[model samples]
Structures are given as C-alpha cells and as structure tokens.
Target: MLQIPSWKRILILAVCLFGIVSAAPNLFYGRVEAHNDAIAAAEKAGFETEAQAAARAAWPDWLPSGLVNLGLDLRGGAHLLAEVQLADVYKARMDALWPELRKALADERATVGAVRRAPSDPGVLRVQIGEPAAMTRALEIAASLATPVVSLTGIGQNDLAISAEGDQIVVTLSEAEKLATDNRTMQQSLEIIRRRVDEVGTREPTIQRQGSDRILIQVPGIGSAEELKALIGTTAQLGFHPVIARGSATGTVPGIGQVIYPSVEEKGLNYTLDAVPVVTGEELTDARPDFDQNGRPAVSFRFNPAGARKFGDYTAANIGQLFAIVLDAEVISAPVIQSHIPGGSGIITGNFTVESSTNLAVLLRAGALPAKMTFLEERTIGPELGQDSIDAGSVAALVGMAAVVFFMIASYGLFGVFATVALGINMALIFGVLSAIGGTLTLPGIAGIVLTIGMAVDANVLVFERIREELRTARGPARAIELGYQKAMSAIVDANITTFITATILFLAGSGPVRGFAVTLTVGIITSVFTAIYVTRLMLVFWFERRRPKTITV
Candidate 1:
C-alpha cells in the first residue's frame, strides 16, 4: 500500500541526478574557472590564443560549468571604503555656470553696467556690477537662469538662490538643489567605480554604497588595494579648450574667463586656455587605444552628434589657432587647428606608452567620476589567510557531517543508511542550487552548511520515531510506515517553514556575509525537506516491496 507513483519516483530520481551533475563542477573549481575564463577571453577577443585553447581543452565543453562564487573572505582581495567629495561637484557646477551668467549679463550691459565675476565661496558665484543702483536688474538676470529642481521632493523649488548683496549679485544652489545634486553625485560616482572595476574582469566585486556619502568596494581576486586605487582614482576627466596663449610657466597670469594649466610633456611650459571647454568627455561615444601616424601610441576618440557639431564649428572658425587637450586640468597637448575637421573624430598624441594608452581608452569608455573620492579605509586580504579559513571550514563541515551520520546509524539500524544517503543528496542539491544561481560563498556561508548537515537528518529522526511507536501498536510494517510519514509531515513542515521564514528575514535585513549565510540556510532548508520526505521515503518503499519484510525496526 505504501508506494510512490511511477512518475513521482522518476521525478525524484531525475532531480537527484541533476543535483549531482550540476554540483560536479565545483569539485574541479580551479580547472573549470580557468576554462571559463578562457572561453570568455576568446569570445571577447574574437580569437583564441594557444594558451586559451589549451585551457578550454582541459575541460569538456558539454558539462555544466557554473561555479559558486567565492566572497572576499574566502578569496583574498582588495577592500576600500571611499568617501566621495560631493562638494567638488558643487564647485564644478558653479564654474560651469559663470560663463552662461556672464553672457546673459553682457546682453544687458547698458542696464546692469559692466559685470565681472568676484571671488566667493566654493559653490557660490558672485557677480560685481559697476552700477550699484542696477543691482535689481542683476538679480533678475541671475534668477532668469534658474531652473526648477527636477526631483520629487523639490518639485516647486528653483535650483538657484539669487540675492543682491551691495553692488554684487550672489548666486548659489538652493538647499533643495544641493540635496538633489548630492544624491546624483553619489550615484554617478558609484556607477563609474563599478564600471572601472568591471573593466578589469574581476569576479563578484562588491561595489555598494555604505552610507550617505561613502562607498564600500570589495574586489575579490584583485592583487591589492593600491592596484584598485590606481584603477579608479584617476578621474580621467578630459576636455578640449581654446588655447589663448602658450608661454613659459614663470610669470604668466590668466585673465578673466581663462585659466593656466601646465603642459604634461613640456615641464616648464604652460598654456592659458578658456575656462569653458568647447567639448567635454561626456559627449564621447567611443575611445580606443591606437597608434599615431608615426607609430607612436595614442588614443583615438569619436564624439556624439551634438559634440561633433560643436567641435566642427569651433575648429572651422578657429583654423591656425591652438586647441588644448586637457585631462584632469592639465594640458596634454596643444595643437594648431590646421583645417576643418568635420567627423568629430581625432587622435590624442602625447608622451604615452602602449599600456597608458590602453588604460586611458578604458577610462574614457567608462566615463568620468562625478567627483573626487578620499579613501577612508583600505585593506588587502592575503590568499594564505583565505586558504586557512577554507581549510578550517572544510574540517568543521566534515566533523559535523561525521557526527550526524554516526548518530543516525547508531539510533536506527538499517533505516539510518537510507537517511545518510538522503543527507548526501541534500548536500548536493544545496550546492547545485547555489551554483545555478551564481551564489557567493563566504566564511559565514560555510558555517550555514555545517548547521544544515545537523538539521538535514531531523525529519528522518521524526519519521523513524513515529514508525517505532506505530510498531508498538501491532500495526503492519507498510501501514505503520505510511502512518508514520503522515503523522511526521505536520511537525516537519512547521519546523522548516518557521526556520525558512527566519532565514528570509535575515536575508532581507542583512548584507555581505550575513546575506551569504542566509542564502545557504534557505537553500539547505528546501533541499533537506525534499530529500527527507521524498527521496528517503522512495528508497524505503523500494526496499520494503522487494524484500517483502514481515516485520521491521525503525
């Protein structure tokens, strides 16, 4: 009477086999990882190198190759806590606003008198007018440039605060706009840092916002914190400005609406350039490392349609004048505009090595960080420490597993063997699910598996004890087994459901290693219930039907 339907039995066996096969790749993690990397590299490059081909051949192409990602603690790497300099964005915004404000005021010079920018706070733009009585007109002109803040909370608020102070008009961002800008700056910094890290092809890097202004970056498999810092800290802000004059760095002073920048190649030379760039890197569509006409390393860049139009007009109108290529506020090159360039494509030639050119191309493609970042904390975890943790975790798991298996066997003679087999299958299924989902394994995750090993046999213990009690009442073996399973079902489901809910809460409320533990616990609960209720029951039903035992002990 106690028998599994044919389809149900087949489904259970199929799932067990799938779990085993899917989890097999983790056993050969090193080889499979190399093979996967090789495949990825070949696809990205559109051709296979000899080493890549050899690595690919090492692993069979037909097998499932998904592996559980190791977390920072499990695979030593770089960790950095960086606070974004949000005020830097405020200054840049003010700087960009000065030109537009100057032009607007210039149109009303008869009413507002001669206008010039005055030194003020970092984020404040101050304008001085010759006619003190026309301060009201200056205020009106500044207010005209203010736009409504484009945020939900700041819906009715304007972005700028304009007030007349004596003969000067003070312009600064409104409080609501400052808040909005801070949010945007943090978001942009996080995205740029993530893009830069991903360009290096590292696995499972944690690039997450920690607090309001800080970002926590944990890049597993990276060489060091310094390496990651170098990759992301460059800013790579590129722009093209019209050069006013090039002279020795000794005593040249920039005029109003202009700035002086030192030449990158020529140490003693400086170039005075317009503060407002004709085109910025934000309009770049593509950048690639290439060789110049003389076979020297260079970076080739193409701009978008709007940028192309602006660049073409500027070059055509200023032929024979010097144009400065600026990166991070330094003049990389100052070349004379020989002819009209229409396509918005150009090469940046400087004292660059091939590696620098490639890095520059990567950075330009990723875009620039919105603001500077200051590293608050930095650490480099060693691989040796990670190996020790892995070894310790492995030993704990094996010991816990051995203890559970021994206890199950000692308490319930031959029935314990069925439970042990189910336990092994449950472990495989847990790993199989983790791999399928690309879950990360941390040190805490390993502890969760050890906890799962102990919990895996709990359902079997309940069923076996129930069966023993049924046998005392003179029920037949088949009838007692069926009743035992039926009676134990409620208790097993209640216990696992409560535990699963707890794990879910932990996952939702936690982060990093806490979430890792929750993931393994959650997966273990599902697989353990499946193995205990279905797989073990199916095994027992088969053995009992074949032998036709008249009497049995749980």
Candidate 2:
C-alpha cells in the first residue's frame, strides 16, 4: 500500500515548517540586518544608546535571526589583488642577524682582527677583516650563530649560509631557510590582514591567499578600494630606539650599527638611533587613543611581560638619555627620559588629530604586516550595480520556477500540484540551511538556485512515468502508486549521488565565485532530494487516503 507511518509524516511536515520559519528573516533583510548590527554594537560597547535600542526593537528577539550573508558581487564593495614583497623579509632577517654576528666576532677580535661591516646586496651581510689570513676563523665565528631552521621540511639545515670571499666574510639566508621564511611571511601577512579587517567589524569579508605571493581581498560594504587600502596598507612598524644624537639633515653620517631618521614634527631635523630596538610593536598587548597633558590627541600603549622587563631596564639604565619613538622609519618623538618608566606603558605624543590617533591605535593593536604589499589591481563596486544583479537573479529564478511548475502541472494534472508545493518547500530549505550555517550568497550562487528549481521536480517525473506504466496493467490505483515509487527509488538515488559528487569536486578545486556556485549547488541537491523522496511522497499518501478512489488519473 502507498502509506507513510504517523511518525514519519510528522517528521516530514516539521522539517518543511522549520525551513520556512528559518528562512523568513530574509524576506525583511534590511530591518533584520539593522537589528543584528545594533545588538552587536551594543554588546561591544557594553552599553546601548537610544538609537541602538530603537533599531534592536525593529525585529523580535524570539524569532530566528540568522540571515544569509551576501558576497561582494551581491553586496558591492572593494576588491584588491595585492602582491606581497617576500624579498623585504630577507633584508629584515639580515639586519637582525648583523648585530649578533658582529658581537660574536668582536669577542674573538684577537683571532679575527678588526671586523667592519661592508656594503653588499640588500639581503646579504658582508664583513671586512683587517687580516686576510684570519678568514677561516671569521667563517667559524659566523657559522656558530646559525641555528637549525624551525620548519619541518628544513630539518637538519641551518638558517645561515656563511662563507668567505677574498678578505670579506659573506652571510646570507640558506635556500631552505628562504623557503621557510617565504611561507611564514605569507601566513603572517594573511593573518594580520584578517585581523585588521575584522577589527573594523565588516561582515564576511574575503581575505585569502591567491598564489605564492599574492592575496585577494573582497570586502563588502566598504566605501572603495582606496578606503580598504588605507585600512590595511600602513605598515605601522613601531619601535623604541636609543637616540645617539640629534642634528640637522646634513649632519655627519651615522656609525655602522646606527640609522638616521627625520623627525615627524620637526622640519629638517634628524636623529641618529641604534639599529636594534628595545621593544617593537609585536610585543604590544594593548593600544588605545587618548589625550595628552596638553589635550592633544595621542596613542597610549602597553607591552607584554618580556617586553615590559626589557623596556623597564632600558629606561632605568638610560634615565637622562633621549628615547626615540619611531613609527615606520620616522621618529615620532625623541623625548628625554625624565625618570625610570617601570610599567612599560607610554604615550606617543606628536602632531595628530583625533581620527589619526584612533587609526594609529587600531593599527598598533592589530600588529604589523610582516612584509609590504603592492596593489596590482583594485576595483570598487557600487551598491546600485549589486541591486541590479539581485533583481536579475530574482527574475531568472522566478521564471525558472514558473516554467518548471507549468510543465509538471500540464503533464501530470493533480499529482503535479503536490510536487509544486514540495518545490517551494525545497527552495525554502536551501535558504534555511544557508542562513543556519552563515553561508555567503553570490551572483553565481543565485544561478545555482535557479538551476536547482528545474531539477527539483525530476524525481516526481520519474515516479509519475513509472505509475503510467503500471496503470496500463490490471492493478488497482493504490498498488500502482506503491509500485511506481519502489521502482523509481534506485534511479533517483544514483542520479543525485553522482551530481553531489561533482559538486563536491568543484568546491574542493575551485576558488571565489566557482566555490560560491558549488556551495549553493551542494545545498540545493541535499534539500531537493529530501523534498522529492519524502515531502512529495507524504503529500501524495495523504491525498490518496482521503480520496480512496478506485480509478485515478496519472
């Protein structure tokens, strides 16, 4: 008999009802979005304003609030393709190594003679020894500083490649170390970019690596590419260096281990500082905008435990000396230490507006980008264009549904009505799953939904065709319907399983929009199978039990 048990029928109806309720929020997307944003802002600030309260009240708190996030193609914002300068990390590595190597050689000055740094390639450190015969001893000293590379593939390999060329000792990163550094640098860049974007509280921004040295950023709801660049482009490299001397821009050249940087506020004035910093922004634990004693906008920062100890000791030892506050390469201020600042907390005071101070705090709190990035391509999509895409996608989906519904009804008369109802439920289930999982919907995803609408009725067609075949025999209506479903089950499962496997492959192998299409297709397939195999069958069972007719049209 064509019958479903009482519990099975209830389960089917409950699932369809749950999907409709969960997807209802999308019908009033704008109001619900505002309500969500308001609640988020209030929670973050720990207090709600009048406007926030009003917005939160726009939607009921008891209803399902999850909404499917729209992608850049549907929401419209900034897109950027940036290339990371991996070579920059090489120079930084060399610079940091120079002080340690120079110290090691100086401890063995009698054997190596006098060691002086010589100019070399950007990523190479070269040292000139006064005695040519001591070259082998110099190489030994440099090699002692090499540590094992801290990567799985670079096991048993040292980080530094040290050799002798004439009277000069050459040191550069080893090949294995270079490979490890490139991967580490790219990973750090991606993490820092994600942090910077997330700090601004944007919804579902795509920050992902594209190739070996490139990143693709798509931030929806931002104003433009330039704004997005301004948010994440600044290196925000902050350091505290001991100032050696201050003079005009044309002053004498700095020593081997020192650098000269122009002051941020004072025109034509420069300060020479130690190359190594007492503490860098990487150790910073907190940073926020504040006002100075003179009511000028500034940034206040605190450091972690290790950095605090180093900073406290440095300030205690050099009480009256100038401490340079460097941002990027320029000295923000080189204030003389009035006392031993033991807490590792300090204020950065310079020429700054409130907005600039706040932005600096945000950058410092997010940490520095490991390497510089150069933007190769940028685009800013308008919201109007996104609305047009949504409108077109809506039209396509509606037309596809209408066509599918008409074909089913014209072919199978009243059974088609049950499949049409199941089709509507199928669409609802797709969006419901998307909302529940916080999935993003793109223009390509819309195409997937439209494609699913046409495919949703496929199982019904199979079953109805099978029933037509059985009706030609001498069997009664109930037995014919039961036989149709039983015979069609194998074909339905096989076809859907094959299509699902293809969707999974596309998802694993593709990127960006292709992945978006795959996500929707995958979700649609699952929902369509459920509605076709179960929901439509349950509806048919109810109709047959009520009518109980001996003769029925196929």
Measured by lDDT, the strongest candidate is: 1
lDDT agreement with native, every candidate: 0.93, 0.92
| Candidate 1 similarity to native, TM-score | 0.97
Clashes of 1: 0
TM-score of each: 0.97, 0.96
Q: How accurate is candidate 2 locally (lDDT)?
A: 0.92
lDDT string for model 1 (178-225, tens) is 999988988888888999999988888888898789999999989999
Write one digit per residue (lDDT tens) for candidate 2, span 1-554: 88788999899999999899989999999999999999999997689999999999999999999999999999999999999998889988888888888889899888888988898887899999888898888898888999999999999999999888999999999999999999999999999999999988898898899879999999998999999999989999999999988989585788877899999999999999998888999999999999999999999999999999999999999989999999999999999988988888989999999999989999999999988999999999999999999999999999999999999999999999999999999999999999999999999999999989988899889999999999999789999999999999999999889989999999999988998999999999999989998998898888888889989897
Over 4 Å off in model 1, which ranges? 251-253
